[model samples]
Target: MKRFLYFLSLRTGTELIILTLLLNKISGFYGLLAILTGLHLSSLQLSMYVYSLFALALAGYLTPHLRRQSPIHVLGLAWFYVIDTVVNAVYTAAFAINWFLVIGQHHPTAVRFGHTILEPENVTSISIILMLWGLRIYFILVIMSYARSVLRQHVYSTSSSTGLYRRENPSDPDSGTSIENPFATNREDGKGWEGRLGRAMIALVRSYWLGVDEDDGWARGMGGKFRRSGEAPVTFGPMERERRRRSGTGPLPPPTSNPAGIPWATQGTK
Candidate 1:
């Protein structure tokens, strides 16, 4: 995530994505207002809003999982964001071309004509277009980087839990754990066309999606920031707890000092 987001700012990829997600949520509200105000949106623009609403619902539902740190939900949300960004850009372009043609009767859209399309003029519109696309690319990278971090961290934590249970290696190396590619495996989770699409997405950015980051000084309790008293802190969250309970490896030993990490996960670690 640092690899993708650190160039833009010191904030983690998750932090950046949260801001972008807020932007999308705000834009969705504007869309709803347009519909309610009886604005004349083209069928295409209307269709875009329909897709926007769907993405809005998904973003609303799954965005909280960022705190929950559910691998499947987080990964699903990340992929949804990527798809929405690309699709929304296409819709925007279509609307722009239609509006430009319609306005051509009053203002010239271009000075020179090409094979089928006109050359874009160096104007406010061009600058805005460039800026929007640049931001979209940055958002895409930040999202993918965060998603990969979640996947890798889940694997690492699960490995740590396993070692704590079995007592096989006190200082167990992760050499035994094969990081599962969520898009490539799992008979239930990684089947069908969605999985294929995920694989294609990963194939396009394999190194970034699967690579390790030096800034992964990830510790326990990055999440569950606002848990109520007696509720399980979502540090490793439900996934880790369920695994530990099933394995009969209960709570982690209490910290000698109440350090940064949450020693209690469910009023107890397990």
Candidate 2:
């Protein structure tokens, strides 16, 4: 239950930040009122606002805890905010259409979804809001995508610059071999799997802090970090491979390296 609450709070905080930024772009109280009034169902809109406020508060309370989680987990939770925004927008549109139909107001003449457009007076406002929402979504997605790419590149670059993701434990040969992001190991040797994992993680952290995209994938200084990529199966460390093998399971294949030589392994090791 605590974990669930923490997750919810993190999600809420992200949403509040986005909302605050969005509100700042608008005029004043009148602008707020306009946006609020544009909603079709007053009660539902009020409920949404209240819920969002509560979520923001909860998020604030859990900020420190949320930060302890992996970046991937945090990014996934933040995405829920995007989903919520889209859902709320849909509901707002639905409510507006119903209200317009009921009041017999000057409905929009534009044909929409096999029917007449609703709420002509507010059509332009609605369109503008939706467009802005799309832009915001795009901006957030781009930032996250860039962050993910940077992290991946950092991992690759730090692991010997071979760009070939490799697993340790040559006994099984293919068993511990891969070409994806290597896992952190904890074996005895300084050259064991843990060392590689530690290096990759450190590089990811450094890249994240420096705002460097080794891949040059996105614009810098966006501060957003939820970028996604094609499903690239990651390489497991020797320990993980042993665990899997002991459990009678085979690991997933490694991701293909970029032709640009995104190094995945150390050069000297056989």
Q: Using lDDT, give the best candidate's number.
A: 1
TM-score of each: 0.56, 0.39
lDDT of 1: 0.61
* Residue 65 accuracy (lDDT) in model 2: 31
RMSD in angstroms, all models?
13.2, 18.8
Misplaced by over 4 Å in model 1 are 1-13, 108-122, 160-178, 181-270
Kindly list the per-residue Cα lDDT of model 1 for residues 119-220, writing each as its tens digit.
Answer: 355256757887988987777777766677776665444433323122223378652323345566653446887677666766665555554445433433
Candidate 2 local lDDT, residue 116? 45
Superposed Cα deviation of residue 48, candidate 1 (Å): 1.8
Candidate 2: which stretches are off by over 4 Å?
1-43, 58-70, 105-120, 146-270
Give the per-residue lDDT of model 2 (tens digit) for 109-193.
Answer: 5335324444455567668877987766754554344334433544443343243444444566655343334233532222565
lDDT of each: 0.61, 0.46
Model 2, position 264, has a per-residue lDDT of: 62
Error of 1 at 87 (Å): 0.9
